[model samples]
Target: MTYCVGLLLNEGMVLLSDTRTNAGLDNIATYRKMFTFEKPGERVIVIMTAGSLSVTQTTIARLREAIDDKDSTPDQSIMLAPTMLKVAEIIGNALASVRLDIESKMEASKVSTSASMIVAGQRRGGGMRMFLVYPEGNFIEATEDTPFLQIGEHKYGKPILDRVARMDMSLDEARKAMLLSMDSTLRSNLSVGMPLDLVIIHKDDCQISERRRIEKGDPDFSRMSEMWSEALRDGFTKIQI
Candidate 1:
């Protein structure tokens, strides 16, 4: 299992993902779940994935191969796609194609080769956009009504986002919301362990504003997690119910 979330806001975008993948109690590993494609100042695209490791890795590898191909056109490469929507289409198609190929080989065992992704970014002179792409290549974009997306062990972390995420939030507030959201998931799900990948993009910057990896022992994250727990306990104590 994995956990990844993306927030789209007026100030920018905030993304976070855990690095753990667990097949069984004794079979666990760490693999990057976030991939970024950028031509700094021109375009920036960040993809966070969940589900089958094989499916997500191959889809990303193939996308990189397409970008490097000599015959690749603007439509064929996410970095060159005219708009963020087109980029989502290109990624969705690539993902579905890869999944079909994998599904064919795994038909006998019925091991399940499904996967999903969140694609978020902006191109020069264009508004930012975010999409949650399903295994079949279809996707849903973030809207004012729903300005965020999540995949994997999401249920454990969704309530905080539902209560706090807002389109007009400052970037710092968004980051804290994302962290607290992740904290909730970590407390409830053993499969969603850290170190986590965090990326922030500022509106119109067309570049990643900041990127950080929060390791298991990171002081700030530890402090924040402890504070959140204490606050929640205090709030509960104060309530009549």
Candidate 2:
């Protein structure tokens, strides 16, 4: 299991994902769940993944292969896709294909394969867009009514987003909101742990504005987590039964 979240705000897009992958209590390990592709001023795309590692990795590998294939056309390569929507479609199709292929191979062993992803990006002349692509090649977009999307161990962190996030929120506030959201998940779930990958892309800039990796015991993350915990406790204490 894992926890990954992305916020689509008027200012820009913010994304965060934990690196933990737990096969069992004794089999815990770290693997990056965030992947980014950019042509700097022309386009920027960020993908945060959750679910079976095999499926996610293979899906990404195929996308990269298409990008590098000299014979690949715009319809197939994400970097050349005419629009962000086409990029999402290409990704969704590849993800679904990889999943089905893996599931077929795992049939003899009775194992299952599935994964989902959040796709966020913008092209120089196009509008910013964000999508939640399901394992079955279907998706939903972020809208003004709900300006965020999340996957994996998402429930623990969803409350904060619901109450605090809005399309008009500043990029700084959006980043904080997501960090706190991840903090809540870290407290409630052992399957989700650090280090965390965070990226921010300013609208129409078509490039990542900032990126950070928050490792376990990093002073800043530690301070933020402690502060959030103390605030939660104080809030609870102030409430009357």
Candidate 3:
């Protein structure tokens, strides 16, 4: 019940995620959905999560634990994984294991405990890569044919991405594309709300080039939303049935 999107462009990688989590209409709260891991110029990995908070949080916690463990190895810690593909595999396996454990423990209550994540990053000497990690320890990478991946209340915002995004898009344009995509979802879904977390990592830089938190009523975002609304209305008026 949240929206998180990542774009893998020739220029860099752009990521955005809403901070809203809702147990019910009256039980809404803001919890950051974006997590970043980096060793400055050496490596950088940004994870945007959606779905059950318990699953995503635990998966991240375990990853961090491995990173901090003095005995961690390439197979155990994502930061030490030789390649981004191996990192995704480790995360997928961790996520699947945590989800299964949680589901088993909650069997008596018959609750669902599943989640998915978008894993994007680059190593100092490696190329930028992005993947959509599924709930069952499997994933698909972003390719030139589709240089983007999204998770959560994604249906409401996918149209704009499909119509406008491309592999060669500039970082600036990619950021706008994702914000507007999130804007569309925000307007149509109550489960997804502000503030939004956005991050941009320039290719091979192995560090976050830009990061921002857009809170509710942030002037710039508000203006963009209003402009989009007016444009939509104008477009509707110009159309003839």
Per-residue lDDT for 1-241 in model 3, tens only?
Answer: 8899999999999999999997768999999999999999999999989888999999999999999999999998999998999999999999999999899888898667879999999997889999999999899999999998999999989999999999899999999999999999999999999999999999889999999999899999999999989999999999999
- Give the backbone clash total of model 1: 0
By summed lDDT, which 10 consecutive residues of candidate 3 come out lowest? Answer: 105-114
Q: What is the TM-score of each candidate against the true structure?
A: 0.98, 0.98, 0.98
Each model's lDDT comes to 0.94, 0.94, 0.94
RMSD of 3: 0.8
Q: Model 1 TM-score? A: 0.98
The parts of candidate 3 lying over 4 Å away from their true place are none
For residues 1-241, could you state the per-residue lDDT of candidate 2 as single tens digits? Answer: 9999999999899999999997668989999999999999999999999999999999999999999999999999999999999999999999999999999899898665879999999998999999999999899999999999999999999999999999999999999999999999999999999999999999889999999999899999899889988999999999999
Report the Cα lDDT for residue 97, model 1. 98
- Alpha-carbon deviation at 48 in model 3, angstroms: 0.9
Residue lDDT tens for model 1, 13-60: 999999999777799999999999999999999999999999999999
Candidate 2 has a TM-score of 0.98
Which residues of candidate 2, in runs, are more than 4 Å off? Answer: none
